[model samples]
Target: RFMDSAKRLPNKPMVVFEGQEWTFAQMHEWSNHLAHFWIAQGIGHGDIVCQMLENSPDFIANWIALMKIGATAAFINFRLPPKALAHCLRIATARTLVFHPAFAATVDAVRADLGAATDTAPACPPWATLVDGAVWRVHPATPPPPSRTAAVDFADPAMLIYTSGTTGLPKAAIVSHMRMTLAAVGFPGMYGVSESDIIHCTLPLYHASAALIGFAQACFLGSTVVLSRRFSVSRFWAEVRESRATVVQYIGELCRYLLQASASAAAAATTDHRVRIAIGSGLRPDIWEAFKRQCGIPEIGEFYASTEGTAYLFHWHRAGAPGAGAVGYFGPLARVMNGIKVLRVDPDTHEMVVDSQTGYGQVAAPGEPGEMISRITNEPHKRFNGYFGDASASEKKVLANVFSDGDRWFRTGDLISVSADGYYYFHDRLGDTFRWKGENVSTTEVQEAFEGMPGLVEANVYGVALPGTDGRAGCAALQWAPGHPPPDADARRQLAATLRQRLPPYAVPVFLRYVPQLEHTATLKQTKVALRHQGADPRVCADPLFVYDAGARTYVPLSAERYVAL
Candidate 1:
């Protein structure tokens, strides 16, 4: 599909990045060269190759090259610590590790651990090397033999995109060529986006939203994409303007950041951009109008989806429309055809409300909040590709006998409601994960990271709602050991530093609460209800609260004044 598109529009601009543009023909030629180089290095069909790189034209080209040889590229999250990075590589059973110069230190930090193969996976091949400018410079600009990719099947794994899917560590979701092809054709047709539309993407290319949804769709539509190294509040509108992007892709947090930064010179820069439609997920209702009006963008296209799940919903917002802030709308016909259900679930335990005798879930009525689930089927469109190497993990998302005997449904792990008018509203995440900085922060993962901390005996992590933020902020309630004292100024600073080194930046707790004891459920499990309700508010919580001061590199007591300032 990509080769045919490139051949048909050889001179069309496919990607624009850092003032450099690559046409379809140029990108194809470069990818061909990369394919030949990797083939020579012994990379073959079905080989798992890992990637750690920032958003760049070469990043996309490298992925294309891997596809040309029928190899699966596992895109590692660059924000992860060395431990998490190693875990991802091991899970993917990657044979080669490829990274850009910017991530050389990160790769080196995990190099020793990756040297030997484990019981479950093989060692990295010795020929696996860094992809520097020198490699591309030395390789001949020629395509590999056609037989290299001829045996590739549509169901073959194309990419391994890691997602923190309501669980403790990141899981590599298997994105098949079939899934990619569907998304490439499905999204553009849904949005009515055409070849003339220029999509501006600031999200990380490692993320499915940017890779499968943004770049793949643009490639399929024969549209141009303006890529950025990272999202910049000040430079965002300028890039969109300069590139004349008709559609700008975003996650909810990016929109909030833009709105927050608009108080400065960025306010003036938001207007007059060529952006007509802003499309992405997590646009909060609180700031939807403000973002569209203040930024001078005419439309907001909000979608609700998961990296590994098959359930998808889209909403195209227009002024005075009923679907302004809703995640999506389920038309009657579409709903029936899709066979999706909203089943009642216990909000506290996140368990489905099922009949004791029949063991079937009770379906929620319209306007009632419930967990949205789709039937698990073998159909190409609705099939669940699941995690790459963990069948048990994948099976956990499938509920047995959902509505009837021997029936199964894919649990979305989201609480949602559909109004009488068919507008669907997002309620809450059903499990131990919450959205922070456009990424899923797993509470269980954060708690596990805090387990061996010197003085901490008990830790409860949860998301706290904050003013002026689209998603929740991470907060951890800590109870010290009997003999250990509470964290002092220096201890707090060192603890913050340790957390920053052990976890991803976004996963680190933004607020800390020192408590004498933690509440528990009747089942003896720790409960976060009280702590989450109190949040990080100093006025409400009896326990001492400290907020992370990123600029100061430590934690400071969150007094009423400090809380108000935040």
Candidate 2:
């Protein structure tokens, strides 16, 4: 694809990064040079090469080089700590580890654990190489000798993208050449992106969103991608305007942060970006229309997909008529062709609601939330490659004999509801829904409600354990809007009242904690595991903790005396 695009549009800019630009020809030549360098170092076809670098031109070039040589690129999260970093490296079983020099200290910290004598030669032939990506741009400009080996196949694994590891250790998902190609070619056309489009990509390159979707789309369309080292809400509009990007990629949290920042920052900072379309997932209904209005971006291409999942949902909000939060709208043909089934399941146990007669999971009724399961098939496009080196973990996501004998389905582990109009709405992750007062509560719904309250910037809702309680109670870690005072007595009372009106009694958060900002995973998803473990204990949390007073109908600080009494 790189060579083909370069041949067709040699002068067209392929990547723009911090004022530096790389045309299709330039990018292809650089990648060829890097491929030659890797081959000279004994890296060959079918070899695994680990990469730990920030979003940069070198990262793109390295990925292309690896793909050209038929080597699987294991893109590692650069922010990982020593133990996790070591684990990922070991699990990938990569013959070579090429990382940015900025991460040299982190690499050295884990060197002993990596079972390597030195950083350069990790007791292996093709060893760890630390390259200063920003400074080291030297590589042969000509293509390397063509391989006498077998041609690369679409079924070959091209990359290993690791899961976010919210529940446990991150599992690497094998992304095949076909999958990458489909995302690159399919999404651009699906989202109405063209060669004239310049995509602003601030998401991490290590993520599938940036690499497979953003970069690959640009490659396939012979378009341009304006790259950022990382996402910065304050710098977002400036970069977009400077790069003259027509479309921007985002995650839900990024949009929330941008909206929150715009509320306080100067209007000129965000007013006039050339962006016409914003694409990605996790934009909730509360912020959807607001984001489009505030940012002046009319089109929102919200999609629902996971690194390992087979099925995908694309919500094109081009002719938007208040469909703020639906992930996607499926026509009758798509409904049957995709084979996406919503099966009823026990909220508490998370087990499928099996029919006694058929011994299969029952399809959920319309408007009722259920776990989404996609049919698995032998076709390459519908195949699940499973997690790398963990067959049991992979098997856990597959449901055998789900609807009929010998039938298999991939468990999405997400709860969603379909309306009579054929619109699909995401409820929450299966694990994020908890029982409170004998009723299931979706943290996403509660969080969205809280975000609607005045002066609230963000809300991270989770269920926390309470002594003598039957199940976990709802707790919210809240962030105040910039320049706004933390929720005062009156504000807290108003917030409580607003939530009471918007949510059911059981769903209303029982406890509230004012935080400066919420912790997030690498992908910017809210992290709840740590907070859930700490519960409402004031000793563990320094934030101003408050509990809802049922009698008073307001939130009051959880003083030590009240804490002990509870």
Candidate 3:
């Protein structure tokens, strides 16, 4: 696809980074040079090569070179610590590790953990032997020698993308050539974008969103892609304006941060840009319409998917009528063809509700929130490749005999509800919903009530353990916008009153803590594992903490004495 695009539009810009630009022909030639250089270094066909670099031109060029040589590129997350970095290379068993000079310290820190290079194959290859990516750019720009080996099959592994590892060590997910090709075709067809469009990508290159959804589509359509080394809220509009990007990729938090920064001088171009559409996942319903209206973007393509899962859901939000903030809308044909099934389950234990007669999981009623599952089959489009090196870890996501004998389904680990009209709404993750007072409390729904609150920028809701309590108690970590005053007694009272009006009594947050900013993963999703463990301990947390007084109907400072009394 890239070769064809380069031949048809040699002068067209393929990648724009900072002030530098590379045309299709230029990048193609550079990739060929790198491919030949690697082949000369004994990196033959079907070899596994580990890559750790930030979002840059070299990253794109290196990925293309790997594809040309029919090698599987193991994309390592650069943000990981030294321990996790070593684990990635060990799991991949790559013959060579190529990285940017900026990460030389990180590589040095993990050198002792990586085994030495040896002729005899061991548990792990010699990842300690590093190759500088800068050296490949100076290689002669020419086409690589034609291979006498057989061509790579469609189902063969093309890349290994690591999961976010929210719970434990990140596992590499195998992405086949067919899957990558489908992603390139599916995103553009769904968004109705063409080669005339210029796409802007600021997400990490190792992520599937930027690599497959952003660059792959550009390669297929011969579209220009503006790449950013990293996402900067202050320089976002300038970059978009300079590149004249028509479409931008984002996660929900990036959109929220942009909206919050709209009032600052840096965001003067918030409503004035060439961008016509914004695409990605995790856009909250409360801010969906507001982001579009405030940013002057006409369309939002919010999708629901995962790195390893086969199921996908899409919502093309435009001219917003506020349709329950659904993640996807399925017509009659899609409803039947997609094979999406929602099954009732215990919110706390995550156990399926089985029918006595059939001994199969019961289907969720209309408008009932439950785990979404997709049927597994041998069809090319419905296949699940699972994790790369661990079969047991991959088997954990498969549920057998879900609805009938010998039937298998892929567990999504997400709670979703489908309206009678076929619109699908995301509720929360399976473990994110906690039981309070014998009733299920949705952190997402509770957090949504905090929207539009004066001085509050964002809220991260979670459940915390309390002594003498039957289950976890509701807690919210709040972050105020820049220059906004922290929550005072009056503000706490107002918050309590509003939450009581918007949520049930049991669902109201029992505690609140103010922070400068919330901790997030590389993709900008808020993480609550550490916050949950800390709970309301004033000794452990220096941030301003407050606890609700049920009788007073307001919140007061949570001192160590107050915590002990509770």
Candidate 4:
């Protein structure tokens, strides 16, 4: 795709990673070199290559390289410990682990634990071993001599996307090249991106909708991009101006981060901003208007999409419509299905219900809240490639025979309502998973990880809407069982150390809430919704919320001064 686009306009900027710019032609060549070499090292199609990397130019280069070999690429969470990394890689049967030099120690930590793939051949080839050291004498390998090629069949699996569920474990969703291409080609047509348009990209490359989709689109559509190592609201607008960007792209909390970074600055008058439009999901209802007003951004076009599902809802036209959570994927024949056939049903059973006010037996009408589902079991346009090797998970996503026998559908697990005039509105979510930092956090998985720790009883966790954050921050209330108040500070410190060792740092709760007793429902399931809503209010449940201080690398009292730093 990059080569074809470059041939059309070789001068167009294809990437700007870490302040370094690469034209379309250069990106394509680098991708070709990486792809051919990996394939030559015995990596084959259908194999997974795990990359534990941060946002960088190399990440984009590696992804395209993997695609050239028709191999599945898995983007592992950089925060994952050695054990979790081994489990995911082994499960996917990853053939090659192409990673940056920064993670040499991470690879060392997991090398022995990688025995999970004992009988299988090597999945990741060591780079240094592949090339002998005489760097000064040898030149970088040249791109392959011109070879024959054909159009990328839309159905080919371009990526195997893994999402951390709020429950169970991470499920790998297969996205086709078609899915990536459609978003690139369709986004511009739908919202207008051109050669003259300069977009600022700071999202991590692993995120499907943001990095891959946006990166591919910019290259294919002849748009210039200004890349940053990570999102910094303090420097966001400034970067846009420096890059002469006309539009800025973002995710849910990124915009909020900008808004909260400096409210007074956002409120300053400036219509001549390098950014005329910004796009992303999770623009909070409460902060949406104020953020736009303060930033002087005329448009805040938000999109809603998930890794597994097909179809996308561009709330570009429906900005501020009270419901805007749709960002699955863009495909042909996709629609909001505002009329009949769109309905919500009992969780236990698929049977539809009638209106509560009137006994009218029919699917939900426009403006009525119902679970958002799509009819695509036999739909040729969107076919899920099954979660890696987990068939049970793949089957779990299907709603069989909803309308009639043998009619299969994909359960979106999202609640939404369509308007009478064909606009769809997001209501709420219905899965155990909640998003944070473009990654899904499984509450059950987190709770399980917290178990077995000394003095830690039952752990209750839920996503609470933070004042200036998208996705629920994991707020937990811990019970200390009678007479078990951490005998000494030594024990408390040990407890914190145990948690850090067992779980990823991000999975660690920001607020360490302690209490003698934790409230729960009649069924005895620990309830945390209210506690989460309250956050760390001192006047309310003053259980002494705490945050993990990375510098000290220990949990400390959640103080306002430190909260600002966190």
Sliding window of 10 residues with minimal summed lDDT for model 3: 118-127
Across 15-67, the per-residue lDDT of candidate 1 in tens digits comes to 99999889999998889888877887789899988988889998899999999
* Cα TM-score per model: 0.77, 0.94, 0.94, 0.69
User: Which sections of candidate 1 miss by over 4 Å?
Assistant: 116-130, 137-140, 165-167, 265-267, 356-358, 432-566
Q: Which parts of model 2 have CA positions greater than 4 angstroms off?
A: 119-140, 148-151, 265-269, 452-455, 481-485, 539-542, 559-561
lDDT string for model 2 (403-446, tens) is 88998898999998888777899999999999999999999889
- Give the candidates in order of TM-score, highest first: 2, 3, 1, 4
Superposed Cα deviation of residue 314, candidate 2 (Å): 1.1
Model 3: CA > 4 A from native? 116-134, 137-140, 146-149, 264-268, 320-324
lDDT of 1 at 280: 89
Q: Over the stretch 1-566, how does candidate 3's per-residue lDDT look in tens digits?
A: 88899999999999999889999999999888888788877886788999998998888888888888888899998889877788888989898888776776787788768863533222323443434445566666876655712577778788999988766678999988888998889988998888999999999989899999899887888999999999999888888988899999999889888887775544447877888889898888888887887887899888888877878898888784456368888887888789788889877789788899989999898899999998888776678899988999899999888888898888899999988888889999887888889999999999989987888888999999988878888999999978988867898899899999999999999889998988877787678888999998898889999998999999989999999898
> What is candidate 4's lDDT per residue for 76-172, written digit by digit as tens?
7665556666666777677666666667677767877665222222333442232222321142444433431233356767777666534435667
User: Which structure is stronger by TM-score: 1 or 3?
Assistant: 3
Superposition TM-score, candidate 2 onto the true structure:
0.94
